[model samples]
Target: MKTNPGQLSQLLKKSLAPVYLISGDEPLLVQECCDQVRKAAKEAGFHDRLTFHADHQLDWNAVADEFSAMSLFAEKRRIEIHLPTGKLGDGRAVLERVLQEPPEDIILLLISTRLDAAETRRKWYKELQGKGVHVPVWPVDADKFQGWLQQRASSRGLSLTRGALAIMSERLEGNLLAASQELDRLALLANGNTIDEETVEQAVQDSSRFSGFELVTELISGRAPHACKMISVLQQEGENPLGLLAVLSRDLNLLLELKSAGGQAENPASFLKKRGVFQPQRARAMEQAARRLNRAQLHEAVALCSQIDRATKGFDPLSPWHYLRDMSALLATRA
Candidate 1:
């Protein structure tokens, strides 16, 4: 049974599905849906809850064994299987058994990142969807984001003026986690007063909206001061270091490829255009940014990014965000 995020609450009110598959790229929404299912299961006599992190190469046996094993503590158990990659891998066989012969008195809640169409076409995936409640959460559209902000504020006992809600939507940059946290902050600070633009302005001055695209644009254009400022704002806004690194790494790889291949073409910008640099403004920005650094400096910047990646993965002692700030400064420097 397919379900939209909005219909999840209503679905939970009915008899719970044996398997609940919640998929979304947004971490907050995915977790929220899982929470709803777990809450319903708890109320329906699922007294014990177990959690498993099934990253790409997870041990399927452990999870399968848990599902098949008899419960010791509680008569009914709820098992949460979190698969970040959304790929069943070797675990597909185990999932087949669980779906074909679900545990007699257990609820299986599966949380995964977004799945591509090709992945979704797999027989196992299709079976899971057919057998369970499949909830796919799409991102909120830009025009409707302000409405979401207003709704979120209302839930927190906030009476936000349109102007204030718009301000919050802009500052939050469509990050639900950030928006939720900011709302928590405002609820305490507002002290029963309505939230106005003036209040939001004062509250989010140091922690303004920080988009990865904008941050990379600033650094690529050699605006070191602006890039550094944005980093501070991003940190204050509770941006994830891993996500920031992903954007920077992608842009750096493109720069590296362009630098290596630019010599073959008469016009570097035109060459970049063939590779999806469609917008004139963005093409010009990349071209200008290319002139600011030599191949060696660009290579070094990529190396720094790799180090930041390692730092983020717990292979280094340095903070990933701190290294990312330093890397931005390095990239912004003229060769």
Candidate 2:
């Protein structure tokens, strides 16, 4: 059945499903759910758990043979199939047949980076849901991030100050892996004491080169030299061009929203606060960009960003870094 994330623990307590289809873009949540399932299976005496990485070349017959094999001890068996790309390939036929008549005494877990497509969902996914459990672990948004942080801190016997939590949340940008790593680091440094904002600020450097607010500060303040330098540094640091494009797109889209709102507030933070831009740094950046750039210029910058993104995906001749540099120069120019 389709299960919500909140209900997963309760579901796990009652009975383990014959098959679990856990799919989402959130790496931490997905892994956590899988870990939970594995732990529960282990507790139920499922010691012979096997793992398979599904790929385009996966052998369906071999997989079937393994699943259908009788356990030496006749105990419960667990099988985890991790499909990172979520493409089942030619194995769909075998999988469908198995799903029609699932093997007894074996718990099958299917993990994917994201949910199957609508068609796949209707076919294999629907069948699994009817016979077993389908859980979708979505990414944690900003509102839910605080609870996650607090729980993480509490688990480590570390108390995090409100200010520190806010800063940590901002720095991690809702990425649980980064947030978890930072929490671990903070726990180590604090030695079970309370972590304050100053500690976080001192420990964490602003490593994000493609941060929209930072880029806006560079462009609006007429720091073309700095903007160019930052772009080069980011590329050298192996930052993904597509990721940078996403940041730019998000910022430009917010700017467009603010422009449409038709406000000339002296403190743009208040205006942005009303518009759901809660991060203080992001609000400040938006304010700066709003003051310096006109609507037309913002639209042009967004278009250029989209073009660079498309070109990076092999639609043009220029390399992603070169395209980014050119776009940065164009953005630096006053329209």
Candidate 3:
């Protein structure tokens, strides 16, 4: 059955499903679903567990092989597969055969990126949903993020002032894992679950220093020097290179999108609406980024970001910070 993340706990409480396809990009939500499944499986006497990560050139036959092997050892076994690439390919046929009559002692848990509508509508997928649970999670967007953070904080015994919560929300920027970790940190420091703006500022250094959004704005508005300076300042202030790079990549993606949408650049509001970007501030930033940079320059920015990505992964010889600083300058001035 198709289920939302909120319904997962209750669903698991009643009975464990034979097969589950939990898909989403949000790490916390996906992890939560998997945790619920794991807990339920363990409680239900499903001891033996096997895990697989699907990559290019993976032997699709391994699915059947592992399931069978796990079942041989344990009466109740679970097989978990991670397909971040979303390339089901020939594996779908294998999965279909495996799940044709969902095994009584085996539970198949498939984790993957968000499946598009077309993929979910496939015969094998529909049958899988029929036999088990299909849980999907969406990110806590900007509009609902603050409230979610507040609730999360409250659960952790941290009572943050509205101003403090706002600062935390912006600093973490909808990252649930980071938000959860920061809440733990705040709770440890909390005298009586109460936190003030200053305490928050101290907890997350540079909460007020330089924002990711401000960096985007400076770059998109063609303030090369300011963008470069902000990059340096933010870097020194302990901003995450990956997070900053993510924001910059988003900016380039938006610009590339606008460039592809011919004649839409003149009407920013309409374009933003068409693109489903609701946040007015972000919409404005994207529109401005699209307007300021041309197609070629935006592509160059994307290439620069790719280099930074490689550096972040230790694939490049240069420091990611160095690549980021160069990217900031390029976006601000040229690309």
Q: For residues 1-335, what per-residue lDDT tens digits would candidate 1 score against the true structure? A: 89998899998887788899898656567767888888899899997888776644457898889988888864899888766545667777888888887886899888775653566777777777777899997656556778888888888899988888777877675466667778899999999999899998888643433576577677777787888898887778666665545445545556766777776846877777766566576677788877778878876775566566557657669877788778777877787
Return the number of clashes found in candidate 1. 0
Evaluate model 2: give its TM-score.
0.61
Query: Whole-model lDDT for model 2 versus the true structure?
Result: 0.70
Poorly placed runs, candidate 3 (over 4 Å): 70-72, 207-335
- Per-residue lDDT of model 3, residues 38-60, tens digit only: 98998898888887666555687
- Clashes per candidate (backbone, < 3 Å): 0, 0, 0
**C-alpha local distance difference test of each model:** 0.74, 0.70, 0.72
Pairs of colliding residues, candidate 1: none
Q: How well does candidate 3 match the true structure in TM-score terms?
A: 0.70
